[model samples]
Target: MIRVLIADDQSLVRAGFRVLIDSEDDMVVVAEAGDGATAAELTGGTRPDVVLMDIQMPGTDGLEGIRRITADPDLAAVRILILTTFDDDAYAVAGISAGASGFLLKTTAPAQLLHGIRVVAGGEELLAPGLTRRLIARLTTPTPPAVDDTTFADLTAREREVVTLVAEGLSNDEITKRLFISLATAKTHVSRALGKLGARDRAQLVTLAYRHGLVRPD
Candidate 1:
């Protein structure tokens, strides 16, 4: 089962998420916290696979909690999915930079939210395509005149292609169809690229791709 921890200041929000998450056959809400500090504490105790974190908690906030959790080597397997009402593009960028696996609006559909939890638990970043572009654009400054070719030197041509597509916000299945490759091949390429690049997750890969000029703002 995919264990989840809900961290939101509002009790009603936490209860609602618990109900929805508990309804899933493959998932469960192992614990809930009303603040970032407590959320961090419960995470260690519950060892949840995914954390549904709200950005604006009473104290310690979601960003700080994410930083704390991601920094712990013992919690390396934990994936944080930031769910909040705030649409400030900067939050999305900050969340990713702090090692969040995904960021979703609280207004997102229930079905999509569930899917996002699964996606992050399966070790993939879950930013929507449009959001991905906006977030990356906000975080990426213009590349220097002298580009660092060696940044991606380790990736093969096909691996580089896969990374670029991922930076473009294509899922593995989408990449398979677009590139006329098998699903397994696409997944393998992505996995290999992540390993070679030493990317903590796809969010970091997206940052690298943009910073290295693999993908440009549109």
Candidate 2:
């Protein structure tokens, strides 16, 4: 079963999410926290496979909680999914930069939310193409400048292509199909890119791509 932790300031929201997640045969709610600090503490204790975090919380906040959990090598396997009421892309970007595996609005359908949790737990990011474009648009105000190849001087041509696809929200499988490369090759490329870029995961890869203007709103 996929173990999950719910971190939200609202007791009702936490209760509702608990019930929904518990109903899933593949997942179970392992713990709950009302703030980021407690979330980090509970996370260290529970070590759930996935954390459904709220970006806005009373004290400490979910962004800080994500940073704390991700910084700990012991909790490196723990994946965080940002579940919030806010529909703003800036908050989503912040959460992604802090190490969240995905971001979804609270109004997301129950089925989609459950699927997103599964995706994150399975080590896949949950950004759709439209959401990806919107996120880029939110960052590049007037226009995203041309990509700087010098910014990626360390990446080989193949690695650059792989990282670009990743920032475009493509999965390893999708990238393999798109580039006509083997699945293992795709995975290796992504791994190498992460190491070379010092990225935590695909989420941070997207953030770095944004910084260097490698991926634009499309």
Candidate 3:
């Protein structure tokens, strides 16, 4: 079973999430917390496979909670998914930078929210399409003239294309259909890019791609 922890300041939100999550036979709610610190504490105790975290809380915010949980060696295996009511993607970028596995809006459909939890728990990246571009845009800045123009020179031509699609939040299967390549080939390209960029997972790969100006926001 995929053990989960619901961390939100609002009791109603937590209760609602619990009901939705527990309804899945493959998942279960191990605990709940009102703040980041408590989330970390319960995480250490419960060691849930995934954490559904809220960005805003009374004392400790979601980003800091993410940082705290990630920094602990004992809790190193925990995966966190940031769920927020706010659309400001700066927090989303910060959360990802702080080691979150994914970001989603609280307004997301119940089905999609459940899918995101499963995605993160399964060690895959989950990014809302709308949030992906804006969040990446926040990470981008003016490129210096002195900077290397061939930012993706290390990646092969096909890998470059694959990474861009990944930054756009396309899954491997979607990439396969788009590129007309086998699913295995698509997965290979993404895996190689992750190794070359020294990214822990696809979430970090998205950030790194944007940092190097790999994908331009529309």
Better of 1 and 3 by TM-score: 1
Q: Which candidate is the best by TM-score?
A: 1
* Cα lDDT tens digits for candidate 2, 61-157: 9999998999899998899998755455777777887888878877888999999998889877887444666667666657777887887889999
Clashing pairs in 3: none
In candidate 2, residue 135 scores what lDDT?
A: 69
Would you list the C-alpha lDDT of every candidate in the order shown?
0.85, 0.86, 0.84
RMSD of 1: 1.9
RMSD to the hidden true structure, all candidates: 1.9, 2.0, 2.9
Q: How many residue pairs clash in model 2? A: 0
| lDDT, candidate 1, 18-124, per-residue tens | 89999999999999998888888889888999999888887688888888888888997899999855465677688888888888888898999999999999888
What is the Cα-based TM-score of model 1?
0.91
lDDT string for model 3 (1-218, tens) is 99999999999989999999999999999999999999988999999999999988889987888989988878867889998655557778898988888888878999999999888887679987777656765777765123234766688889988988988778888999999999889989998987777666688877777777677555
The backbone clash count of each candidate, in order, is: 0, 0, 0
Error of 3 at 109 (Å): 2.3
Candidate 2 Cα errors over 4 Å, as ranges: 128-131
Clash list (residue pairs), candidate 2: none
Best by lDDT: 2
